[model samples]
Target: MPVEPSLRVAMTVEQCWQPAPGGSGTYIRELLRAYAELDDLSVTGISAWHRGSPPEDGPLPVPVRRVPLPRALLYRSWQQARLPRTGGADVVHASTWAVPGRRAPLVATVHDLAFRHDPQHFTPNGVAFFERGLAIVRDEAAAVVVPSSATAADCVAAGIEPERVHVVLHGVRAGAADPAGVATFRARHGLVRPYVLWAGTREPRKNLPRLVAGFSAAVRAGADLDLVLVGPDGWGDERDRLAGVSADRVRVLGRLPATDLSAAYAGAHVFCYPSVREGFGMPVSEAMAHGVPVVTSRGTSMEEVSDGAAVLVDPMDEDDIGRGIVEAIWPGAHPALAAASRARAAQLSWSRAAAQTVAVLREAAG
Candidate 1:
């Protein structure tokens, strides 16, 4: 009798190592961490290009191979001329846009459809590249994975067959709050008492300008709360969005280390993410996981992921956002909301996401 061969899977994780902005890095890192726990599959982490050696300081669950080439070089070589370095796996998984040619089936994760829905949010060149990349995923990939049902809908709307599209919500871990770390973070950032937190890249889709306006409006409405923006600089000038807000009341505690970030989430009086759109609002779920009351945009992925645990507000309306913030931080205004948020967060976990993803891969590979 012939023995069954192992299922070799190649996963593109350059984003996990690159110093790129946004949470796609976290999504890939966390998914890989969870995948490491599974035994039935043999996974090879692939980074086709890197500025330096991939960070291997942390003990990874699987072996990683860096292709020793830059992204542009690889794109020109594989996309235009040669075969990609997919490690001869039974399946190839790309976390985002870099879907390479391979003998095995390709699985692509579509994080969001913001590029299509709001082309103005991106440069014309950027929009063109995304449209081309997504078209490739739809036309060529064996299966497409999305972080939210909203994103899945977007894919179908864009002409992807429903059967080929899978909705896999992002899993979040709610770790224990470190009081000492939280204190250090607050002191280091000089965060005043009772601050509202907003964490995301400072991009237009995040609606930072409106968020700032809402925070200011809340302040005028008798809420003495500072707004803590935790993320890296992205796309545009931060000062433009923060034009009218008093500098002292809003602190941009640019991206914190993971532990410190978790502590920031735990320490906040409330977490508000009024992004105009999202595939899955990871920060909202992260805040909910930490028992932080949340206020997020309505009719978007935030509403889908939060599942009524968060106060929904029109992201475009500063007054509505301001009201939601006021209601969130007011001592006795929404105790049950936070409790519900914690409960809802507990239901979402990376282990589950990994299991679902593995199952999807198995079906796609077969």
Candidate 2:
């Protein structure tokens, strides 16, 4: 009998310390936890030297070792000099693009090429950073993993070989939301009426201006629902957009804790995410897992994430977005859609994602 080779992986965990961890942070945490549940590979996390621990450390599945260098210098070296070698592992996974040198087989995860989709949303430096990262992955990485087919297409368009691209759907872990917490969340936030919930980092690509306008239109149409926004403030604050919207009707609760976020999901009338583009739209999947009907953008990855269970709208058109929100809100909670949402979300399992990830690691290692 022939012996199979053991798989060992070293992955980057530097994003955990970023102020706004965003979708990639959630993806990393969930994937790592799921990876721990499996025995196929031994995983080690790598981070730049830092003083404080990450905000949420429970989901880090592997022991992390800190390199002596700081983040900014380390990233620059990875892109240009390819210094600070990351060896001693069969394969190295750049969970984000802050990858190590080509000392080991590499697999890079591409969340989205949002700058390519909406260049106006990013600063020149940010766009250049992404461009540089893509060039590195397209040239050196053995495999490029993306969360959705949409992102895979973007990677191919950026000149990566189609054979090197793999689409891995993310898994959702619904929080253990207490019922009293739901009531407290509603009371604490003054969510007196049925509210449409939107969550994620408040970045421009998320299309928040249009959402604010659309929610107001929905209110004018007598949808009778407040709009609750949950997320940390990213670039381009939408305060100017909110000038047209009544203050009481739209509650920007800022970022909430995991329990409160889950409670928000559990208590919402409808979850609305009208992002113009996304890699996978984790919020859509999370909302669906919580048994909520969703309203998301059409023709983006969120549309694919919804799988026809959500009310889809034109992300560019405030009228259309408003119409979608109203339709999702007015005629009562969408029991049929909720059923389909749960059914679809059920099929997206962390265990399955972990197994598929291992298979890709094996391929890279081989």
Per-residue accuracy of model 2 over 96-157 as CA lDDT, tens digit each: 87878757899999999988878889889888888888888988999988989999999999
Give TM per candidate. Answer: 0.94, 0.96
User: Candidate 2: how large is its RMSD?
Assistant: 1.6
Candidate 2 weakest lDDT stretch, 10 residues: 236-245
RMSD of each: 2.4, 1.6
Please estimate how well model 1 matches the true structure, expressed as its whole-model Cα lDDT.
0.83
Candidate that scores best on TM-score = 2
Tens digit per residue, CA lDDT, model 1, 125-206: 7786678778778877889999989999999999999999998888998766788988988898888577899998777889
lDDT of 1 at 195: 89
Error of 2 at 29 (Å): 1.1
CA deviation > 4 Å runs, candidate 2: 1-4
